[model samples]
Target chain A: MIDEKGILFILSGPSGVGKGTVRKALFEQDTNLKYSISMTTRTKREGGEQEGVDYFYRSHEQFEQMIHEKKMLEYAKYVGNYYGTPRQYVDEMIEKGHDVFLEIEVQGALQVKENFPQGVFIFLIPPSLEELKNRIVERGTETEDLIINRLKEARNEIEMMDKYDYVVVNDNIEDAVRKVQSIVQSEHCKRSRVAKQYKALLEVDDK
Target chain B: MIDEKGILFILSGPSGVGKGTVRKALFEQDTNLKYSISMTTRTKREGGEQEGVDYFYRSHEQFEQMIHEKKMLEYAKYVGNYYGTPRQYVDEMIEKGHDVFLEIEVQGALQVKENFPQGVFIFLIPPSLEELKNRIVERGTETEDLIINRLKEARNEIEMMDKYDYVVVNDNIEDAVRKVQSIVQSEHCKRSRVAKQYKALLEVDDK
Candidate 1:
């Protein structure tokens, strides 16, 4: 039987699908889950996000050094900032029994899945394109051009849904969170793990 | 972008996991879902069970005839009686926008998956073996030996968990029903169906 180990959950979605809101709800309700902090080589914007909490902002040279040392699991460039997941910290968290949650874009999600074949990949989708556009407009942080770009990106992202192991539609926050929770709970009962446990138990009887 | 077509759901569980209760709750909430009436060769026991509603009880020769005619999708022998699903009725129900639900054993579920390939298979599990035993005992319909036999069979059935597309742990009735509902809803967003629809929509723009 596979021993009780930490599970890696990858959450990917378009910008306006409420993936962040659902992730926040999941963290608030689930005490055992840990949010993975990505390391980035960029100046922290005016937001008062902490160093080790929100992200591990580093110098570009330092990020390159880590990559050359084979320390980063996966990395990608967005605008001017270089963001990557550090292999060591995630492994340590898993060893300590924390279910790590990686929130990334569709491309990053595919990279993580390739690196860790056992990781659970979940794609969050909006109920409809109209709802997605409305949500993006409600945010009021982007102009019309940015919103349109996001929608175009969303159309492309939805095409990668088959690569994911599960899909959660964000029609309602509570419903989506419950669905993700149930998925994590059910994965623990997979036959590959449970069968081994049962075989060990049966061995005791034979003795 | 997938068209609004009903999907088939196959539910399988051990004898005492309260699948019947969960199914009842699901059907009560979602009137659009069609609970498949299985065809059986067993004689109807005296308890006000209706034919064509509860089950389509047929003679042994008639059941064999259906199987010979390739009308039965999958069949199995249980306690000297044969039970099978009629493909024609299920297909008609799906065409009419009703999701068909087949409640069967793990073996039957596997057979259905192999035959249909498009059917969604879900495995329902108890919270624990002790809870399962307690539920079976509470029924008070069988001898202690029979309960023991059922428990043993449950152990064997659970070993087949990996074969299922999704596993729902039935710790609470309402929660399990909600989980099943979410799974069915999310399945509609699968890329195999959605991507094709989206591609078709984009084709007009390409021209």
Candidate 2:
């Protein structure tokens, strides 16, 4: 890594918080951010998923090997398949002075925090629990039982919000993206991150 | 004060760091912010300054009396004149839910930090010391001796930058304003500040 290391933003939120939409809009507005593509053992769907684009699709054996090798940044099993953020790609992008965004669940985000304590942990939330429930219901992508489970999961997720450094309420799409963008820019200006830049600036002789 | 206290931003930097220009621009862009007007023992300049506009021009006796009453948020003497941020005004603004910006010197800033420890401290700076000296020279408001003294003061001021939370380089005015605005917006999203909001949201039963 250069003297100025890039920031790692761990953005985690409960399901149906519009996090994906917010992140997508954020990327559209600010192309400078780099999203760390996660590795998953889940079978890629037939139609449109591309390798290294949607995800780094790994077989169960390969995924297990990575876990054994301790190459996963943070991993979890869901529906009998493994999902995780890879450690190497994050390191590479960060070393190259790119601010890397890791969109993971709360459990995975917390695990990554242990390994990379410097990451900016942001917990996204809906304007209200009612709104969150409404979004999930409107999607109609899951069964009623699954929806109830998701809402229950959301309540638990909300409890752990205090663990993150910042919280962004995704009430308005552009507003939420602007808030995240502001956080990243202000964070770049933090003394812990900008101290070296000042040191180098001070080294220049006043002629 | 309300359950959700307004954020106090303590902004400080060395002379010739363009802090005033940046702050002015910041106010212009974000009208919601409140500038914490200071009380000074020094006489206000005759030509344009207004009472309670530029400063609350206080006589030495009145300033000393306030200090005796522990009314100043933070105070220091420079060139035999007392300058301080009045505690009452800051509290009033914060209670009213206005994000307050207190611009002061390093000594005064550190003092404010002790009393208002929750305030977000931001230190503005030039990209380089050489640039700082150049700006001082370009102003043409001070003599060569004063300019030299200012640069020396800047060097000493910069040494204490690590004590602050964030540092914004005033290389470009618009960029600096955006960074400060971002900091304010993001600070609002901090869990500590938003916890009560969440509590209220949770109180509402989902039908």
Candidate 3:
């Protein structure tokens, strides 16, 4: 028995693990899922990304205001930008019975988990380090130094996999997508949520 | 990053909740899953059920002797017959990377959970009490009094739904089977297992 209150899913992975691509495929297939778009204080790069759709681009002051108001669920300083999850939109989607997915780095994921203890954490991994390096190099976006830096970061990320609730090895895109879909479907059947629904059904009092 | 040591899933539900029917559908879809056949001291019913397949139908003395030898995982008394899971076969299947499914009553499921705390517990429920009664009545093997008794037992079973790790409502067989399948698949991705695999993959010599 699934509750009206939706489950929160936290997805974390290395840069080359294809989390974004898998998420895109998942969203295209699952209409009920809502992505928790983070508010960032960084300028949107070229390609004409929208303010709200791509990211809720905010000023440093605005981001600071959000933090002071306790509106941010979890926030972090990454590179020169401040990225954070806004609590209101996520809560609204969950209240509307749509599962919310937050795509964040390992540090932000840990923060989200600490705040929302009931959230399900999933760590994505590449099939092998060599494969991960190949995928990163194939992207052609990063320089040699950046690629090496990413590989180092990936090693650090892999070590933090134990903090997650589940891990999906991105050996194949389709298989990884299926594994994530299965994880989300399975989390909905968790006993804490189901027991509450069952208890409510029993308390119907058929007089 | 699923390991060679597969998980054990304990599935429990009332008789008419379609546990066996769903299990059949699951096995048909996923051949990797191995069902744990219980060892019993009861005579095989007249439908030509084979030994070690339907059940390992042993003599009362043999069952008692095995119990004394501590070979059984969890045993129960049912209708003047003894039924229990043999630990060796289940352990072997799990060690060989076959996820094992044990279909048992709530009591047996609880005992298995107590012993193996990490085992995934799934409870199947009918859509409604009326639907459950209809399914039971359709069987035509039981009198009205017996049907009433079964329903009462079902109510008791439902009370223990909280004890399970997951509760899947079997309104639609396909959907229910998909849910259970997802659960078993996702349990393989649990962080504890994945982290250990990740550590092994690091290949750094630990003196």
Candidate 4:
């Protein structure tokens, strides 16, 4: 076995960028990928998602303790709920050679960038603002005012593209997924990351 | 149409490392890629390859004048023949939105790196030194002494892998080709290159 360390991919985009759909498609294509389940302080409703699968449900006091202990990779308070990625599972998955994908908001993503600078940060976007607005309307799940809010939020998020390492335009879901997958594969071959592998190979004697 | 600027990929490896086969396979897969045609001062043999397609034949004086004018991206003298990549065609191709793949030796690749610092430099290598020597001997195209010399040259080249941006191990030709192609695709999506596109998208006014 190569025992290669798995890459941590931080994926973030605005609300109407179709990031969730693209991420689902990518996971379907690559079995070696593991999605990072976040930790949240929200209440678990009846017949709601599973605890470890969807998220690690935590009490407000516990979440605060985690923050104080510096266990969260990135955290943010949204709508009075504390949401963040815990570092333990991510560390375990990477050690076992499973690439971990963390989907987060821009603020939380930047927080992760500060904590783990080695992670590859990718920002997904629509081809244009007009297309983004159209996608939001086509979803048929939000009110007109909410749609406008999302569009404004997306505009602001797009300005942070320079902070990320790669940008994937979500013009087509399949194409975007393929581009993200390629980025993961190629990042593994970067010289800075694979210098140890090269050294091991070169150290072998030749007769 | 997206007027995307082309990327220059500089590939360097020792002789008999299967760079030619990998490059041929990659070109067959991506029609948008352009194989760089080198300029050589050697005399064209009868029933040989076509001009401008295989190599740009030049007189010694013309080649020296090119050296004087600093027109070569990289050049080296071997067996009294001056072989190099001319800058004019590469510049034109890249300007026309064609990604140029320059396959050269290690020294020439370092020269191109000096000349075109923006190009992505990749060092191709065998999986192991034993495999490298085995492949050299298996080729059956050189004498015993030449094979030994080539193996030594390959060992020296492997030490230079640190100077590259990426490294591709040619354990399997198909896999190596896919890795290189993925590197090319992923590099275009890098934030350093796509930030301008994001800026253009964000500049579109929304009401």
Best candidate according to lDDT: 4
What TM-score does candidate 1 reach? 0.76
CA error at residue B81 for candidate 2, angstroms: 4.2
Kindly report the docking quality category of candidate 4.
medium
What TM-scores does chain A show, candidate by candidate in order? 0.88, 0.90, 0.88, 0.92
* Model 2 ranges with Cα > 4 A deviation: A1-3, A42-48, B1-3, B42-49, B78-81
Candidate 4 per-residue C-alpha lDDT over A14-96 given as tens digits, one digit per residue, 9 for 90 to 100: 88888889888888888888999999999886797889998899999999999999999999898999999999999999988
lDDT of 2 by residue, B108-184 (tens): 89899888888999999887788888898898899999998998888888888888889888889988888889889
Q: What are the Cα lDDT values of the candidates?
A: 0.80, 0.86, 0.85, 0.88
Task: Go through the candidates in order and give each one's DockQ.
Answer: 0.21, 0.69, 0.58, 0.76
Clashes of 1: 1
Q: What is candidate 2's CA lDDT for residue A102?
A: 80
What C-alpha lDDT, on a 0 to 100 scale, does residue A140 get in candidate 4? 97
Candidate 3 chain B has its poorest 10 consecutive residues by lDDT at B198-207
Model 2 chain A, TM-score vs. native: 0.90
Q: DockQ winner between 2 and 4, please give it.
A: 4
Q: State the lDDT of candidate 4 residue by residue for B1-207, as single tens digits.
A: 246789899888877888888888888888878889999999887886778988999999999999999999999999999999999989999898889998888999989988999999988988877787788888878899998888888877878888899988899989999899889999989999878867785675454
Which 10 successive residues of model 4 chain B have the least lDDT summed?
B198-207
User: Which order, best to worst by TM-score?
Assistant: 4, 2, 3, 1
lDDT order, best first, reads 4, 2, 3, 1
Better of 1 and 3 by TM-score: 3
The TM-scores of all predictions, comma-separated, are 0.76, 0.92, 0.92, 0.96
Error of 4 at A176 (Å): 0.5
Top model number, DockQ: 4
